[model samples]
Target: MSGPLRLIELRPSPNNIKVRLGLRLKGCEFETIPVALDDAERAEVLRLSGQPLTPVLLDGDLPVWDSAAILRHLDTIAPHEPIFFGRTRERIHEVERWERWARGVVYDTFTIVPGMAFRGAFDPAEVERANAEMRRHTARIEEALADRDYLLGDAPTAADLTLVPMVFSTMLTEEQAAASRIAAFLRQHFHLGEERDRTRAWVERLMAHWH
Candidate 1:
């Protein structure tokens, strides 16, 4: 909090997107340094975070790795505009629960499936399984949003920021798809469909409001 924040990232990564959204939500002005999967960039990342991972946040001289950890750091630095809504103990736990689910369930599908597709190891059955898993997950999101505009309430919290980008990958616009092969792959394979009406609408609403 004492120095200008710096986010080391791969631009198209959903985890990186979550950190960016968290920073914006907290009204923090920061600089983003985009990195690639190359030897030089990997060494830089390892030096900064002790691991070669994108989305390493330099908070002053403190390097915080992992998207969730970075978001928690944001809340610590900017408590007034918390990523966890209300700043209550209960709300913190609730938001953390959602973050875990997002990382475990939603993030896994987006990462594994896309990694396979991008590697040219694509299998129709694998994609079908991933798509089915997505539908199941989105159905849960739909039910969660049944009585609220956002995941925890009317305002977007870390939970929403964490999940939205991963979900958005599945429903990317033509322009978004054209820009990123990973996005194109996700759009081609994962279909949210009309069944997840509320979840689909919620993703669109958050994209318009936040992005």
Candidate 2:
């Protein structure tokens, strides 16, 4: 608590972004140390967390691994502001559920598809499969947003933290990132239209936090 939290992460990692958003939502001060997902840096991460992964949070002498653990640790120490997991048990369960879904389904789709597409190293069938998976995950998100402002309710929670970064991943090109603002970007990339108006609005509202 004496100094800023040290967050070691990969710049484009959704997992890292989840922790970053959690910190921001709680109004915690932290500094980011970004490393490439290359051999040397991966080794360095292993040295720090005993795992070859990013988004490791250092709380003074203590090191926390993964976004889920980092957010829980932050709540334990920085208990004065927005509660990342929500105050109620049901809300907490819902938030955690969506967070896991984000990691497993949403993150996988966005990362696998774009990573393969941009690299151009995957077979055409693999590309199609990736896109189809992405669509399935996205439909789930759209349906979730149909009746609520946020994933859980009116307020943003850790679920938003987890999913938003995956949305960021879909902004593959520099032009896509720069030219299209949040709603437009979501619309274009997700192939959303009037049918997904609520989801589009939710994205725009979420963008207000950082953009």
Candidate 3:
């Protein structure tokens, strides 16, 4: 094997989850390094990374931060089976569109809207708002998933990989009564496994080993 890709995983991070999922899908091995990003450690992280975020991948001397960037890096390293399944640029753009949607819209509402609207921080009010907002987002997501088994199409795309982590742990611990379809999809495909058979299995395996 080539030298292991070094990964620094920050806590309470869904973006990191997507990067980890990408690595798993590409069959790339990496050293997972847990980092703290919630407080004073954030400055340390920024100094070390020259950025202020998690899911940082250190490949030899090259450092790649951000989930989408990490996914692209992994794809280049192992090109045999691409994490992105589309053969056409249009299809790829479709996946990218949803990736951006999840990043900007869904996660934005679920993660910070609740707090920002009332408490000026991600607090109970934020959690409450997140639930209502997440429900609304989930309705749209459920509609998208109604005909296809996965979010993008019949097979899971980067869109699914991106959203799972953002919504998965939060929905379970913070909001237990999340929309049924989203929760069921995560449980069945990511947590429990049935509608899943590929990268989904890999994700379950990683959570077991990492946490």
- In terms of lDDT, the best-performing candidate is 1
Q: 7-53 in candidate 3: lDDT tens per residue?
A: 88864467777777777766677778777543645665576578867
Name the regions of candidate 1 deviating beyond 4 angstroms.
Answer: 37-41, 208-211
Flag clash pairs in model 1: none
In angstroms, give how far residue 94 of model 1 lies from its true place: 1.5
> Which lDDT tens digits does candidate 1 get at residues 1-211?
7788999988777888778877876788988777974445487788877998879999888899988788778878887754554477899889889988998878778776788766978888878887888888888899999999889887878889889988888788788888766778777777777777788888888677344
Q: Which stretches of candidate 3 lie over 4 Å from their true place?
A: 37-39, 42-48, 113-128, 173-211
For model 3, give the RMSD to the true fold. 7.2
| lDDT of the candidates, in the order given | 0.80, 0.68, 0.62
Error of 3 at 28 (Å): 1.6
TM-score top scorer: 1
Candidate 2 lDDT over residue span 136-182, tens digit each:
66677788888888777767778887787766454344564553243
| Candidates ranked by lDDT | 1, 2, 3
TM-score, candidate 2, is: 0.78
lDDT of 3 at 147: 64
